[model samples]
Target chain A: MREIILSFPKQFKIGFKAAKGIKVLGNFKKLLICGMGGSALPGEVLKIWLKEKEIKLPVEIHRNYSLPFNVDKKTLTIIISYSGNTEETLSAFKKARREKLKLVAITSGGNLLKICKRSKVPLVVVPKSYPPRLALGFLFSSLMKVLTNSKIIRGISREILSLESKIKLKKLEKEGKNLAKKLKQKILLIYAPEKICVLAKIWKINFNETSKVPSFYNCFPELNHNEIVGFESFGKNFHTILFIDKSQNPKILKREILTAKILKEKAVESSFVFLKGKGVLPKIFSNVILGNWVSYYLALEHKKDPLEEKLIAEFKKKMKV
Target chain B: MREIILSFPKQFKIGFKAAKGIKVLGNFKKLLICGMGGSALPGEVLKIWLKEKEIKLPVEIHRNYSLPFNVDKKTLTIIISYSGNTEETLSAFKKARREKLKLVAITSGGNLLKICKRSKVPLVVVPKSYPPRLALGFLFSSLMKVLTNSKIIRGISREILSLESKIKLKKLEKEGKNLAKKLKQKILLIYAPEKICVLAKIWKINFNETSKVPSFYNCFPELNHNEIVGFESFGKNFHTILFIDKSQNPKILKREILTAKILKEKAVESSFVFLKGKGVLPKIFSNVILGNWVSYYLALEHKKDPLEEKLIAEFKKKMKV
Candidate 1:
């Protein structure tokens, strides 16, 4: 039996309260989130849930080590570091404070907390104890609360609650009823736009680390330009192409639909999963729950034991550098 | 033995001669090439080569469907489609021409030819036979001839001869002799300014198509800020990390070395690939030659014929709607 590692989720009340407690910070021009991996998933959820919301400022995620050189004081940066010690987030926190941009931070503890204390930036302390990846729901909901309170987005609370409940509808993936399990022998290609892309990325990472499967995620509109043509060669050996389609610009949306359809006809097997939701948080959460459950099922499907990551652990131990 | 589809390149002189006879215009403020896999490699080669050139016009290769929205009349757009049918390139070409930007075309034949002919723009045609992947030397040399004629850069004759010799070096790449073969299961994280990132991207595409590996190319100091930290978690599942290190600024150079060392410590496996050349054409061609040889060798290592592409053929036959 594979050792599965996951805590029975705490009463979803913590996330619910945090999501309900978001407050508006007046005068921020753009909502910028500087985060990586699990911490960043929340921003993606918010963006996707709020796709229809008239976003006044472009919300950009800084996944690299530094912020774009052109950032100005008008930017509202939310620095996310699970350990609070994440180096890149710390670098960005210092830079944001140096420029005196408005700031917020999410973490249990680390240099982020220290810097936020020194700089007097607002802090939202998440519950510590679990891996950062598992903390995605809380982080994502909190970020959504902030966006909604700031009026950059409206109506996300119900979506979060809705997603929390709907996840049960996907059969609570115990053992045999898992879609992700089927993906074990195949490469997982998660395709989506800005918000969904983050969820997809998180899902890919989860599959890689937990299941030890090589998976990938990419954004749309961009993929159509180069990667679409690439599939002309992927053939039957290529198992699946999953498109997490949400609402997008009419023309670009059509391009995606047409391309996915063309690829399906061209390839041995492909899947087009169109998803919809009331708010960004809910919609992103919707995909997150599906991916999470499916990957768990996939873990069981491959009989790889859902819990062990011997390769990653061994690599880390050997490298101590 | 597996069935052979695409064969090892046999005759190359005609391709080389055709490449030697093209011309590029020189009045624009910036050079932007609309390119996909085949000729895109040349764009990257030129970026590296130009760093050492006597006179250099800043060049950008738009790899996606949309030209950077910042593009305008001062941009000299070169649309490159080896088969002359890439949709993204065509889209950008249409937009560039519609905006009245000066345009040039490199293609064998397709709508690109008609668009250029009817619009009175110049077109340089190559013989359409070999895989676009194998035809990089011809395309790079041809583009160089154009740039040289248009007075964008100097030292073309020498560059072509160098490219020719380099292509010869890539033939029948065998085990220990093929550098590219060793890079399988590695990442080509290229770091350059947006202008030069084109070169790095070409290296990545070559690895993906020719070598069948996962590779990445990104520009810096943007990378300095973000992606560098990913090494901490990358620990060791990877085989290597190759930086298409070019001779550039002293500050950027120092940062790159430090970044590589940090990544090396963090990576499971890694190495640095330095690019050497005296002008735009030579450097670009050199990298391509090295990459091509490496990939060919890698294909051989897998005990599979390098030229067979059964999947892509099937994709063409089955894709519909």
Candidate 2:
């Protein structure tokens, strides 16, 4: 688990190179990226990036079976399934093909890859064997490359190159270990600025799957409207973690600080984890790395195997997935 | 709260009538519904309705300030703020105007209404004074009428008319009251089918604000991918509510049943709250009404004032919103 976390940044370059020749032909009006679990994470990251760059294309992530109701001929649907076998993604891929929409598929090796090859659909196959959650670099970069090659978005070569250098793992590992100590036996409530709320969700998912603990997440401004009231009645057993980005809107930044203060007033333990780095990629990837380490260390603190998702495996077997 | 819940269905007819003379002139390619808190619930419900009817126009709900990156002149932006003063929705409305997108506004009475009236934006003003969360019938039906008026979607007048008759408030209130008794002193984990997961989120919000308790929600299939593991290590003090819609994909129905069985195996107390009626409007509103009763009754059980969001009120004052 530690090795995978340490080498995570290296996947970006490999992923970018893997999709060099793959592109879907379309004057796409919108994008529908379909995936489930970890594969869906990239679609979300792309959305934040698109918004940050002020890209005009609307991007929607479909995490269920088939396509969204709004999908049309001008939609470029990208199917991402790390294992290429995710039932939902496969269903979406089949539907996209049936609809005769331009399609792209990203996977390591599964039925998705084979079907895409057989159907002559464009695809990028990443390195196999890593858990989908830990394969973000590969899935995200590959998806971005496909978008770039398709002329849907400008190239992000500089951002992709800086990831490995921008992310400092040793320091984050130490900080994560310390944070994990405080989080021991406590439920987690993660909050992030609305623009990058997906990171908060990713962190919660890590805590659940890695630490085998219950964690919940919501974005700021939105959470301020209703979720903050949840603290009015109870707080002792829950720890609030705020992802503070210096680059966010000042009003939003103020909301985060005030929300933390109110939670403190309600006797809730809270931590403000400031996001580091200058560019959007580093800020995002840095948080992702920190979360990976936090969940990894928290798993060790609980005497659980971070790499083992026994319950998921069992549930999948029962469902015949 | 009881009186409001009992008469909730009646708002549908009143809401539909409120927008009778309003219409935006344009060939809208998409719908951008902007609002926050309870105001955002209507947009989500509309997305589900659009999907059920397979409407091709993409509808995106923006819960934060300004506009999404993809908003353009071809987008019909609907600003819904039950209080009309919601800062986020207000910001979105202003952005929509500045961008010169086709505009429609829905509010009881607030700054949003004033701005729209002064700016000559087509608007719908519903009855005032209900908490935005309980004002769903007004906001939802009114927004639908705006879409129908603009020819964005087919008319839903028949469905709107059936809401009051189809949702049996007496039966749902009784059921909700009984469910609240079982949910007392327990944290809630509400799960719904992925297609209408918005209902799960609305249910969570009701519990958080009305019942003054912590509640979290996620959808099926998606939750099966990661969240199901959280139950492996913890279950006590948690009550899981499953919103079972008989009309969902058979595969999804199977997943929900299997998921509940797994939760029971993990010793988590589970309840299957079947959604009533045939049409989408009734199924959704019935669940909404039931949630209102449960949250209202739960507040009574805890001696908490269901209508008072003291924390939200205090926080907003601190933020000076």
lDDT of 1 by residue, A1-321 (tens): 111122223314365565455454767666789886567766765554444454434567776455655456666788888778665567777878777777778777877878777766777777775556667866766676666666666666666555555444334334224455455466556666533567657666666655555455666554543344434333433445454554554545565556567567656366655564444544555555555666666666667655554443333233333
- Show where candidate 2 strays beyond 4 Å: A232-234
Superpose all Cα atoms of candidate 1 onto the true structure and report the RMSD in Å to 1 decimal: 8.4
DockQ of 2: 0.66
Docking class of 1: incorrect
Candidate 1 wrongly placed segments (more than 4 Å): A1-32, A43-60, A66-68, A98-101, A148-169, A172-176, A180-200, A217-241, A244-283, A300-321, B1-82, B88-109, B119-176, B180-204, B211-288, B300-321
Best by DockQ: 2
Error of 2 at B288 (Å): 0.7
Cα lDDT of all candidates, in order? 0.58, 0.87
Q: Candidate 1, residue A127: CA error in Å?
A: 3.0
Clashing pairs in 2: none
Q: Write the per-residue lDDT of candidate 2 for residues A1-321, one digit (tens) a residue.
A: 999999999999999999998998778988888998899999999988887888777788888988877888888888999998888888899888888888889999989989988888898999999989999999999988888888888868878877889899899999899989888877789999888899899999999888888898999789988888765555776899999888777889889889888888877888989987678888889889899999999999989899897787777677664
- The superposed Cα distance between candidate 2 and the true structure at residue A29, in angstroms, equals 2.5
In TM-score terms, candidate 2 sits at 0.96
**DockQ per candidate, 2 decimals:** 0.08, 0.66
Worst 10 residues of 2 chain A by lDDT: A228-237
Please tell me what DockQ candidate 1 reaches.
0.08
Model 2 Cα lDDT, one tens digit per residue, B1-321 = 888888899999999999897899798888888989999999889878877888766778888888887877788888888988887788888888888888889999989888888888899999998989999999998888888888777768888877888988899889999999999888889999888898899999999999988899999789988888766555776789998887788778788888888888877898989888777888888989889999999999989999997788787787775
